[model samples]
Target chain A: MNMKLETIETDVLVIGAGPAGSTAAKHAAMGGAEVLLVDKKSEIGTPKRCAEGVSKNGLEKLGIKPSHRWIAAEMDRVRLVSPSGIDVWLNQENVHLPETGYNLERKVFDKHMAMDAARAGSQIMVKTLAKELTLKDDYVLVKAESMGNHIEIKSKIVIGADGPESRVGRWAGLKSTSKPKNMESGVQFEMVGVELEDTRAVEFYFGSVAPGGYAWIFPKGDDIANVGLGIINSMTSKNAYHHLLDFVRECKATQKAVSVEFNVGGIPVGGPLNEFVTDNVMLVGDAAGQVNPLTGGGIISGMQAGLIAGEVAANAINEGNCSLENLKEYETRWVEENSLSFQKYLKAKEYLLSLSNEELDSIARAFQGSDFERIGPMELLGKLVKVSPKAMVKLGKIF
Target chain B: MIISEFCMYCGECAGVCPRNLIEVGENTLKFGQKPCKNCQICIQVCPVSALEVEG
Candidate 1:
């Protein structure tokens, strides 16, 4: 046995220091629990993986005000480019962007959230990689390597905010339900010299170019943007990176863009895991797959879920009952708060995935200048019926 | 073993490779100086059937 290892105890242990993990740590500590948060990265959000867009109102609903330090740009409008290159402009009251979305400087944003959690009295350790964990019914023991030292942490409950791989959740023996079809492969380039139509509008391109997924151009300034695309795993026999390069070469705006940084990663399109809580373990964030399928957004939902999980975790520790039944409250509450929108959007994703390039073009043209603020399934189907009844019929059945 | 054209750039293969022999690059995969022991977990975990072993 290694006796030089340090042992610490806390009421809650959060793995990963991403936005979700920090939020969970903050709330749990505020609820009077001794919380410890850890991440393998030296910095929480370096080498950015996301397109860094957040719904303004959605952040407000979570009580988060975008700090100017991390707000790259504020967007009040968006344009959806169809396969045929027809543009559909959507503003407030019409699309998911709803009121507005903010392009973020994630490095600053993640550090701010993590610092906030530390201020709330949550102990944080960076460069700590969780290697193994054991559940002992009443408590859990997490084995990790910090810097060059071995450490053991004992906690009443563990919140798995680790991203898609979710080593902590898997170590706790929680089963996830993500399917191959429920995930996407994404590649992005933060490029300079990309022109923006509107300084406040992000653009989305939908067509065969992305193959069951979509491409995005979110501007950070008048001349710089994060240009990216996600492709369904089953879409083609070619590398997703190649498709993104093709996009950079083909798009008028990004054609001459000079790449500043590159990011490649997996995106979960699944709504949520069925059983996220095990004895003494509560899963949060990407570990629970809380990303919205249709929008391919995870940060807002993950933070919200983390908030709920932290409160529930502290309660379980206080109640001295970390049973699965007690932890089920987190699951029930998150589902209640998110199920309606998430499920509806997931169904919409399925409907959208079934469409072909031609059908997608027709749908985009039908919604051109749809003066409406927002559209529901029935309204969209009604419009599509005029353009392509065949698509309408298939979509109606799916919806 | 060889990688096919279906590499999606998800980079999961590089994470699971025991020998740390793979590096995901801007447009192509980079191999380390060491020879691969053919751990094949990269093949098993690939979602798109991009990796294959020659008979």
Candidate 2:
């Protein structure tokens, strides 16, 4: 690692090099802004925090084509497991869903995305941690440390693409705190000896295994999978790791599985922040709480917001105005694009959190042997309402 | 706040801190100079229960 003291200036500065930051940097550079993107980690992505599942449609939306280099597995089926071990399966032919796509090798995928940003003329820096932000009238001064070397970056706009533990939002004085109930504590293990009922399917287990959230087995190969779970800490004293261990121990499919890697992180399940822009600073991705409240999935959404923020920042810089009023466009556009679905998901999440183990099993029972190919979402909900009216009361109104 | 050796520097604590008083490096977790209100939100969110109140 080269530790060099430096001072640089750019039209846009992006913090974090995850999916959101990389996409923001790529799009901003493509928009003709002189962009600089930085990540605190020595590598762009490692110790993977996600289940690495993404849809073909999500990549299509971002104009990204699937490459075998970063694709671990192609999935056509999604299995939802009940507390009592009943499984309800859905496939692409049965229902159009975003989750029926492919499992990604995020380590390779993230770096490739960053490489796209570099190809678009964005300067990239790894092992660079942004320490402080100084707000100025026209530009923000960023004090960063790169491998023990102090560096300064002055930019017309700063995009906060940092992950869940985002400091950028806080530094900019945004109301960025997620309530304990709204945050999901997640733990995952890359297990090599896992047995899968369907090698091409991704499985989700719901009930006591994970309170508020659910457990998942995202297969990376025929025999290896990223088995994980996320649970709301406020709902239980057991913590996420224990819940994951319990799930693994209890599941028949993972009896022979041994963990080769352990990963842990937090997911913000709150809807997007009320505001993600302040003067020249705009927040994207998890920093802006742009994750799906129900699924705890943010990669696609984050990248979408990143593209928007990149373009908006570039336009604001081109117009020589990086004011709060100018950056407000980003928030407005993002909300317009996501608010409806996000709100619905938030309500569904609340409903899901209220379910008991029995309620979960009953709901799964309702779907057992049902022809998924002919069942619409409304029919599914109707079944849910029949099986668990008490829990469905809240969910009914959301639909 | 005390971060135990069990900590993996995953930043779950920092994200849940209402005061934004924790910073996570690659292999480090440090409380900011600002006084922690002892909200204990960090402790609750820790996956391995790695964070605790200072004695």
Candidate 3:
């Protein structure tokens, strides 16, 4: 490939305008820096792949109001089903927020966010792809392609908001790879004509049905719902779609239903990245492994990271110091705020994935009738240890 | 350049544009004529209306 033939300049350049990139761009621009945000898709939110679940608290932090056009439904409760189909209902009374979750129209949500960043004065470029990053003498060179033409942008600072399969971080000299076993392949479908109550609840099914992972039903509305499942990559003996199909067939509502849409994607279960920053670049959101280890939710964490990266980048730019030492502040802020939760969740995830069907059932039985307190990762791990100390002892090895 | 609300801040257009004429901000997206050659390539592939050619 010919080296980039076109050249540009910016105070800050952010890649992969997903949740993280948008957040970074928004905050960075608000901080008074000239920012450029870009994405490769023809539409901001087309080819939807996420289950579109975000915590209520997460949305508020971003100053985003839940619009009906973007919100499929409100989730106030969660039902955890064991291997034998024993249901444990966790009500709103147990959680801090009354409305705990939002079922999102990701396409709309993503697009609106990008627009918000634009409204904040950041320039956004769509349908452009970042091919690589070159470290110039004092700045970074972003090589890209647009409409079959080459382009390059020089910037003092760069943010990588790219997704799990990010090449930006790798190209920027950061270790951004994930192990196969630490990844989960997922399949989701929007089914219409299904008869279901219009309750704001999310459901989880664990057992051989989902194997290594679980299945979920997030109601979009009274008649439409997102029925999806994720299985660990190690359990790829069977296709993810086949598992989703089997779950759909088993669902009483899905019988005689027509499919309105289908989506397939992968979730990184590898926990957070070991490092999220380097000299001139920072990684945020999925690229930084900000998704929850238990539920595979990243909107909240991604937004959180974006907020921090934005502030840090803006500060660095204002100070006229854009170096690895300065950018490391973003890393510190993120780790100080979320490292504990992330580490604990990562441990719990490892333990959960290694449990047998019988073990899962036993643990569920132990937790039955218990008050559904909001349990942190360590608390959840402690419960597992209390239930089976031997298993907990073995967990130490896996972690 | 004109940016539509559909832009997602991917930064690809700014990264690859010949003139580098894009800047995405919080709550708003904007662009400046910072050496833009008006190659019109950015207008061709913006995944959303976030980018457009200016006369």
For each candidate, give the TM-score of chain B: 0.80, 0.92, 0.60
lDDT by residue (tens digit), candidate 1, A1-399 = 767779989899999888899999999998889999998777778757789998887788878777999998888788889888888887755555632488998889999999999999999998887767899968999988787688999999989887765656666766653455566777889999887788788888887788768899999877889999988756776656778988888998976689998776667777788888989998887778888888788888899988998899888888889899998998999899888888778777777777778888887878887876667767877877887776555556655
- Per-candidate fnat, comma-separated: 0.07, 0.74, 0.00
Q: On a 0 to 1 DockQ scale, where is model 1?
A: 0.14
**Candidate achieving higher lDDT, 2 or 3:** 2
lDDT of 1: 0.79
lDDT of 3 by residue, A32-93 (tens): 98999988766887767678888887788778787887887888888777877666778766
| Residue-wise C-alpha lDDT for candidate 2, range A316-379, written one tens digit per residue | 8889999999889888988998899898888887888788898888888888777887877788
Error of 3 at A323 (Å): 0.8
Model 2 residue pairs with clashes: none
Ranking the candidates on DockQ from highest down gives 2, 1, 3
**Predicted complex 3: CAPRI docking category:** incorrect
In candidate 3, residue A287 scores what lDDT? 77
Place model 1 in a CAPRI quality band: incorrect
What TM-score does prediction 1 earn? 0.88
DockQ list for all candidates: 0.14, 0.81, 0.03
Can you give the TM-score per candidate against the true fold? 0.88, 0.97, 0.81
Judge candidate 3 against the unseen true structure and give its global Cα lDDT, from 0 to 1. Answer: 0.74
